[model samples]
Target: MNRDRSLRYRLAGIEIFAILLALLFLAPFYFVLVNSLKTLGEILVDAASLPEAYKFTNYSRVWDMIRFPTALRNSIVITAISVAGIVTISSMTAYRLVRRPTRFNNLLFLAFISSMIIPFQSVMLQLVRVTSILELRGDLLGIVVCYLGFGLALSVFLFHGFIKGVPLEIEEAAVMDGCSPYGVFWRIVFPLLKPIAVTVVILNTLWIWNDYLLPVLIIGSNKDLTTIPLAVTRFFGQYTKQWDLALAGLAMSVTPIVVLFLLLQKHIVEGIASGSVKG
Candidate 1:
């Protein structure tokens, strides 16, 4: 009886601790949301306190100042196209590597894995130079192509691990049923990859959506191609920080991605578990 009581107490304590930890992590979001409704002076004077007057105009002003609609459209186009390319190319590459463990394929897989370790910072100069030389700089295609190249290694690695767990007999059965290789892969293998694919989409979407640096470099001086992150920078200049407007812009920018993550969050764990077990 005493041991049972002790275990119950321990579990209750753990739950309480978890709640506090969650609140700690959520504190930044609290500040952002709260300050977003305040005036710049109010935010500066008492950032943690509630607004005396909720200046909702901050959002409207930020929206107009940043040309939010244009930025939103640019972000959507780039993220969607880049993620689609990443998913298609990575899955196909991973499938081929798993199906054919030839020396060349193995070497190629290693090369992809190795590339993942190279930091984007290290290649920034080269990236800018190469894109410029190819006349890809400042074009929509430029940023999309860069995203595809950088995103491929990690996506392929994830897909590779998950695909290994798939049974070879399934592919064989499809082949015997007179399915072409393409049909076997697309109809049979690809469908089974839904969990990992969703995971890939979510991860890459978050990365590409929030990304600022890549767009700055590749889409330089192109106001039409400005993304959310880039647009938000208007609130911060050399010395001044428009906290109210900046926070409002951040709140607006984060809402869609947050909704997306919450909706699909369950799949993240499922995909990782499935991949680890299968690999």
Candidate 2:
């Protein structure tokens, strides 16, 4: 009876601790939402306090200034194209490596995996130079290709582990039925990879969409190609900042991703759990 009481007490403590942790994380978001409704003067005076008079016009003004619709369209196009390329190409490459398993293939896999550990900052200058030389600067297609190069390693790594768990008999049967190599992959292997594919798409979509640095470096000064993050940054100046407009712009930038996550959160959790188990 004493031991049972002790365990119950411990569990209660843990629950309380988790609740506090959740509140800690959520406080910033609460602040942002509440303050976004306030005027610039209120925000500057006491950001933590509730607004005396809510000025929802901030959002409307920010929408116009940031060209919010165009930014959303650009982000959607780049994210979709990049996610598609990463999943398709990485899956095929991982499938080949897992199925073949030759010494050369193993070495190449190691090389790709090794590249993931190299920080992008280390190669940023060189990457910029190379992209410029290739005339890939300031284009959505170029941004997609850039995402492909940086994102491929992790995608390949995830697909490689998952592909190993897939049964070889499926491929063998497809081949025996006179399906060519490509047909075997496209018909048999690709279908089974859906879970991991969804996982990759969600993960990469979040990263590429929210990403600021890469777009700033590559797509900066190209007004037509400005991403939401870059556009939001424009609201801040060296001498003075547009606090109200900036907050409104930030809210707009974050809303889509938050909505997307809420909708697909189940898949995201399932995918991560499955990948961890399989990998």
Candidate 3:
């Protein structure tokens, strides 16, 4: 039928546009990967062209130079702990804020939402002072704590809106079935939060894994606690620009994030679609 053909045409156009957009976003990665294999001389000459010989040695050199294994372990540890903490605490906090709706809860919710507007720079000094007082500086635990603080606001806000959309009747039914508060949340509510949880995981993982500023301010002296971003930064110096190592290190650093994003991208889209349907 004509209508079917028209629908097909529209879908085709949308797919084409979406693919174009995806390629546009991936352009930077292509540039980085290509240049990563090239020598500094080759990069300087023509970054776009393929290397005459793929110097995978750049990867090996950068790996050793930046203590890549240690950095990776630290990044994974920090990101995992920070993300898990954010998801657990924010989910509970948001659920309480929605279900309770007390004046104090409302005020607290407003505070979390409002905190998002404050730039990190404006509060950086005060944050340092607070961390020092709490003796949470110059340690891995300290940096993770910092991430939890900075990551909580946006995450709690997101969970607040999402939890509000989750039907109350389901929770009420769970309560009636002799489910305790914690049991109901863990058994019924939390399981239903898979979609939004994916979003939370991806967002927090990327931010915490790549974050350099907070780590520098908090635990920069602890070389053992340095993250991928910090390691890559220390790889570069003032007078001597090791473009070969820098480019290779950048490629290595971004690879995990790119892989994670791609792996979880489908879940994120599904989350959005499910949220729309629920709304």
Q: Residue by residue across 1-279, what tens digits does model 3's lDDT show? A: 999999999999999999999999989888888988988998999988988997799999889889999998998999999999999999999899999999999999999989989988998889999999999999978887888888888778878888888999998998899899999888999988877887777777767887778889999888988888888888886315777778889899888877876887887667556544543
lDDT of 1 by residue, 35-107 (tens): 9999888888999999887678989988888788998999999999999999999999999999999999999
lDDT of 1 at 170: 91
Per-residue lDDT tens digits of candidate 2, residues 239-269?
Answer: 1466777777788889999998899899988
lDDT of each: 0.88, 0.87, 0.86
Screening candidate 2 with a backbone cut-off below 3 angstroms (N, C-alpha, C), the clashing residue pairs are none
TM-score of each: 0.91, 0.91, 0.85
**Candidate 3 RMSD to the correct structure:** 3.5
- How does candidate 1 score on lDDT? 0.88
Candidate 2 accuracy as lDDT: 0.87
Clashing pairs in 3: none
